[model samples]
Target: MNFIQKEFRHILRDTRTLIIMFGIPIVQILLFGYVISTEVKNAGIAILDLSKDQATIKITEKLTASGYFKIIKNLNSFDEIEEAFKQGNVKEVVIFEINFDKNLENFNSANVQLIADATDANTANIIVFYTSSIIQNYVNEQNKTIKMPFEIKIDERMLYNEELKSSFMFVPGIMAIILMLISAMMTSISIAREKELGTMEVLLVSPLKPVQIILGKVTPYFILSLINAVSILAVGYFVFDVPVTGSLILLMAETMLFILLALSLGIFISTVAKTQQFAMMLSMFALMLPTMLLSGFVFPIENMPVWLQVICQVMPPKWFIIIIRNIMLKGTGLLYIWKETLILFIFTAFFILLSVKKFKIRLE
Candidate 1:
C-alpha cells in the first residue's frame, strides 16, 4: 500500500505522464466523434422541377423539411446538374420530368430522375436513399387519397442506428482502440522503462512482495484508464450525441474489465521486453494493429478471410467492441453481452496468470 502511494506520488509529479494519460484521450475523442462524422445533415442538392405543379412543389417541401437535404440550386436546365456536381457543393440532383403531374394523373406513374455525385460512393448512396425514401413516403400518402393501379411500395428501415450516424458506429470502436492503446501500450512502456533504469532490481530487493510491486505498478494506470473511459464516454455523449442506451453501470463495468485485460497484456509485454522501445514496438504490433484492423474497429470481422476471422476471435478488443456496441447501440442488457463479458474475463485471467509465471521465472 505504501509502495502504491509512492508510485502515485511519482506519477503526480510527472507532468508529461499526467498530460498524456488524460489530455490525449479527450483530444482524440473530440476529434474523431465530432469532426469525422458520416451522418448526412443539410446535404446540398439541386432540383430541376420541369413541371411547375403542386405535386412537385409538395414533394420539394417535404424533402427540404426532412432536414437531411438542402436545395441549394433550382436548375433551369438538365445541363446545370453536371455544373452543380463539378462545383462540388451538391451531392445529388433531383429532376422532375415534363408533365410530371399529367403523367401521374393519366398513366398513374411519373418519371423522376435522381443523379448523385458518386465520387464519395457511401455519402452519395446515403443521400440518394434519403431522397428516395422521402419521395416514396410522399407517393404513399398521395395514394391514400386516390386509388392507383399497379402500386409498388418499398419500405426500408435501419435498425440500431435510425439516423444512420457514423458516430454511432465509430464512438464505441474509438473507445475500445484508445483504451487498449493507453492501458496496454503505456503500461508496457512504463514497466520497461523501470527495467532500463534498474529500478526493478531495487524494487525486488525491497520488502514488498513481487505481486504487491506488480499491483502497485498497475494500480495507478487502472485508475487513469477509468478516468479516460469516463471522459471519452462523456465527450461521445455530449458532443457527438452518442447514447448509452443500456445500463450506464454495465457499460462502466465492461470498460473496467477491458482495462484490466489490457493492463495484464501490458504487464506480460513488459516481462518480455527489456527496453521501452522494444515494449512499444511489441505493443504496437501486438495490440494496436489487431485492435484497429481485426477487432472490427474500421472493418467488419465477417468480411475478413476465414483464417483472419479465427484469429480475430482471440483478440480482446474484438470482444470489447462487441460488448460496447451491444450496450450503447443495441441497448441490450447483461444477458445479451454476458458471453462477450465472460470472454474478456477469461482473457484477463489468462494474461495475468501468464505474466505472473513469467515474472516468477525472471526472479528465479
Candidate 2:
C-alpha cells in the first residue's frame, strides 16, 4: 500500500505523465472513426482516337462527362500511348480502331482497346468500370437513336488496376497507420519511460530543463519516423509504381506534422501511466485500434457504426491520411487540404498546451 502511494504521488507530480495517459487513446479513437477510405475517385485517363468518327467522338464525350475520369492528354498514335503510360500521367488508355465506325456499321461490333497502367491494379479496375460504363451507355444511346435491335455489340477495352488490386489499393493506408503506430505512439511511450522509471528525476535535477529533456528524447524519434515514412513511400512508388502526384515537400511536411501530433499524444500518455505496461496497453487499445479501424486507413468510415462515426471526429491520423491521399493520389494543393491541415494543427496545439500546463502544475 505504501509503495503504491509513493508511485501514485510520483506520477501525479509529473504533469507530462498525466497528459500522455489521456492523449494517446483519444487520438486512436478519432483515427479509427473518420479518415481511411477504399472508394475510388477522379482517375486520370488518356485517349487515342484513331477513328475520330462520330461514334468515337460521342463515346469520348460521354466518358469525360461521367465525372469519374479526367482527360489529361490526347494521344496522336498508339506509340504516344505507351509513352504516356511510362510517364505515369495516364492511368488508362482508350484506343479507338481506325475503322471503328465502319466496322460497327458492317459487322455490328467495334473493338476498342483499353490499356491500363496495371501497376496499381485496384484503381485500374475502377477505371475500367467507369470507362466501360460510358462506352456501354454510348452504344445503348446509339441503338435507341438508330432503332437497331441491339444487334451490334460493344467490346470491352480494359487493362491494369484490374480486378485483383485490393492489396495495392490498401498499401498506402496500411503503411501510413502502421508506421504511425511504430513511430509516433512508440516514441512517445519510450520518452515517457523515464518518468515511469524514476530516472526522470535524475534528468530533472541535471542542468537540462524539462523542454530540453523532452526534445532530446523526441528528436531521434522524429528523424526515425520521417525515415520510415520516406521508406514506405519509396516502396509504394518504385516497387508499386504508385507515383506521388503532388508536391514532395508538402507530403513530407504533412507527415512530419502527423508524426509530431501522434508523438505529442504519446507523450501525454506517458505522463499518466505509472508503468510501461499500462502505457503500452493504453497506446495499443487507444492509438492502434482506432488508427487501424477508423482513420479509413483500413476500413471505410462510412461503414462504421453511428457512435463510432461520431467518435472518429477526434482522431488526428484520419486527417493525415486524407491529406496524404489528396496529395499523393489526387495531386491536389494546400488549397484543397487547408481545412484539414488547420484541424491537425489545432489538435497538435491543444495537446501541447494541455501537456505543458499539466507539466507546470506538477512541478508545484
Candidate 3:
C-alpha cells in the first residue's frame, strides 16, 4: 500500500510522464471515436443527367438528401467526366441515359451507369451500393402505382483500379507510414542520443551554422530514408503489384521531399527532447499515429469529422500519401500533385526553421 502511494506520487510529479500515461490515452480514445469512421459522409460525386427530366432530378435529390453523397457538379459532357475524376474531388459520376424517363415510362427499364474512381476501392463500392439502392428504392416506389414495374439497371464501372485490389490503397499508405516513422523517429533518436552522451555539446562548440548542423545530422538519415522509400516502392511494385503508372522519377522525387520533411520534423523534436527515449516517444505519439490514422492510410479522410479533416490537411503525411496514391494508382503527374508537393515543401521549410529557431534559443 505504501509502495503504491509512493509510486502514484512519483508518477504525478512528472507532468510530461503523466500526460503520456493518462492524457494521451484519453485523447486517443476520444479522437479514435471520431477518426475511425468507415461510413463515408458527403463523398463528392457528379451527376450526368442527359435527360435532365423529373425522374433524374428527383433521384439526384434523393442521393443528396441521404447525407452520404454530395453532387459537386452536373457534368456537361463525357470529356468532363474523365477530367472530374482526375481532379480528385469527384469519387463517383452518376450518369442517366438519354431519354431516361421516356425509356423507363415506356419500356419499364432504364440504364444508370455508375462511374466510380476506384483507387479507394472500399469507398467506391459503398458509393455504388448506396446510389444503386436509392435508385432501386425510387423504382420500387414508382412501381407501386404504375401498371408496369420500373427498373433502374445500374452498370458499375470502376475506374483507375478495375480489380479493386486493396494493395492499390495500402501500398501508398504504407509508404507514407513507413517513411515517416523511419525517417523522423531515427533522426530524432540519433540527435537525442548525441545530446544524451554529451557529444552534441562538442558539435555545438564547433564552428558550424545551426542550419549546417541540422543538415549534417539529417543527411545520413535522408539518404537512408530515400533508400527505404525506393525499396518500399520496389516491393510494392514487384510483390504487391502496385503500378508506377506515373513517372517513376517524379514519384521518387516526391518521396525524397517527404523524407526531408520527416527528417526536419525529427530535428525539431530533438531540439526539445533531452533523451533518446523521449525523442522516440515524441516521434511515435506525434508522427506515427497521425500518419497511420489521420493521413487517410487505414481510413478514408472524407469519413472523418470536418474538424478532424482539417487536422489531416495540416499533416505532412496526408499530402505525401495523396501524392503517392495519385502517381502510383491514378497515373497522375506533377500537374495533378503540385499542390500536395508544395504543401510538403512548406512543411519541410517550417520544421527546418522551427528547429533552427529552437536551437538558437537554447544556444543563448
Candidate 4:
C-alpha cells in the first residue's frame, strides 16, 4: 500500500509525464473528432464563359446555390484559366464554348470542359463530381426548351482520385506521423538512456568516436521505422485497397530518406538533453507536435493562417506527406515531386550535419 501511494505521489509531481499519460490521448481524440473529417465542402471553382447569355448566368447561379462550390472568377477568355489554376484556389474550371446557348438549342449538345487541378487529387475529384451533378441538374431543367430527337447524357470521370477512398487520404499521413514519432521520440529517449545509466560514459572512454556512438544508437531504430513504414503500406494496400499508383521503389526510397532525417533529428535532440525525461519532452514538442499539426495530417494547409502556412514549409513531414500523396494517389513521378524531394533531402543533410557537430562538441 505504501509503495503504491509513493508511486502515485511521484507521478502527481511530474507535470510533463502526467500530460503525456493523460493530455495527449484526449487531444488526439478531439482532433480526430472535429478536424479529421473526410466530408469536403465549399470547394472553390472558376467559370470561363465566352457565352454571356441568360442561360449561362442561370446555370452559374444554380452551381453556386448547391453549397458544394463557390465561383471565384468569371473569366473572360481561355488564357485566364491557366493563371486561375496556378493560384491553387480554383480547384475546378468550367469552360463554356462561345456558342454554347445556340449549340444547345439547335445541335442538342453544348460543349463544356471541366478542368480540375489534380494536385490534391481527392479534393479535385470531389469537386469534379459535384460540379458535374450540378451541371446535369441544370441541363435537365433546361431540356424543356425544345423537343429534340436525340438526348445527350453526361458521364463524369475522376482523373486522379478515381475511387475517392478515405484510405488513400489517410495512409500517407499515418505513415508520416507514425514514422516520425517512432524514429524521433523513441530514438532520442533510447540514446539518452545510455547517458542516464552511464553506458555512454563507458562508450566515450572506448575507441568509438561520439558520431559513431550516435549512429550506433540511431541505426537500429531507423531500420525499425522503415519496417514499420512498409508494414503500414501493406495494411493500406491489402486491407484498405489503397493502391500504389506510382513507382513503389521511389516511394520506398523517399520514405527511407525521411526516416534517416528523423533519426538524425532524434540524435541531435539527445545530444542537447542530459536526461531521458528532457529528451522525451524535447522530442514530443519539436518532432511529434510539428509532425501532427503542421504536416497537413488533420487540417488542410490551404486553410491555415498565413503565418502557419509559412511555418509549415519548414516542417519536413509536410513535404513528405505531400510527396507521398502525389505519388500514391495521383500517380505522379519524380518530375512532379522533385522540388519537395529536394527539400526533404536538404532537411536530412542539415540534421546530419548538426548532429555531427553537436556530437563533437559534447565529446569535448
Q: Which prediction has the highest TM-score against the true structure?
A: 1
lDDT per residue for candidate 1 within 85-197, as digits (tens), equals 88988888888888888888888888777777765544665677778889889888987889674232223333222333332357788788788888888888888888889
Q: For candidate 4, list the clashing residue pairs, or say none.
A: none
Off by over 4 Å in 3: 1-154, 157-168, 360-364
Q: Where is the poorest 10-residue window by lDDT in model 4?
A: 28-37
On lDDT, who's better, 1 or 4?
1
For candidate 2, write residues 72-102 as lDDT tens digits. 8998987787789888868888888888888
lDDT against true structure, model 3: 0.79
lDDT of the structure predicted as candidate 4: 0.75
Which residue window of length 10 is worst by lDDT in model 3? 28-37
Q: What is the lDDT of residue 182 in candidate 4?
A: 71
Over 4 Å off, model 1: 38-42, 46-59, 62-68, 72-168, 361-364
Off by over 4 Å in 2: 1-168, 360-364
Better candidate by TM-score, 1 or 2: 1
Q: Quick one: ranking by TM-score, best first?
A: 1, 4, 2, 3
lDDT of 1 at 109: 81
lDDT of 3 by residue, 1-364 (tens): 3423433454457676445434543354334323322446899999998999999999999999999898899998888998899889999999999999999888888999999988877778767877899998898888899887878899999997675534224667767876777678877876787788887777678776677767666766666567667766665566545578999999999999888888889888988888989999999999999988998877777768999999998989989988988898789989989999998999989988888888752443
Per-model TM-score versus the true fold: 0.74, 0.58, 0.57, 0.59
lDDT of 4 by residue, 234-332 (tens): 766775466799999999999999999888888889888878999989988998888888888766776689999999999999999989998998889
Q: Please, what is the whole-model Cα lDDT of each candidate in the order they appear?
A: 0.81, 0.69, 0.79, 0.75
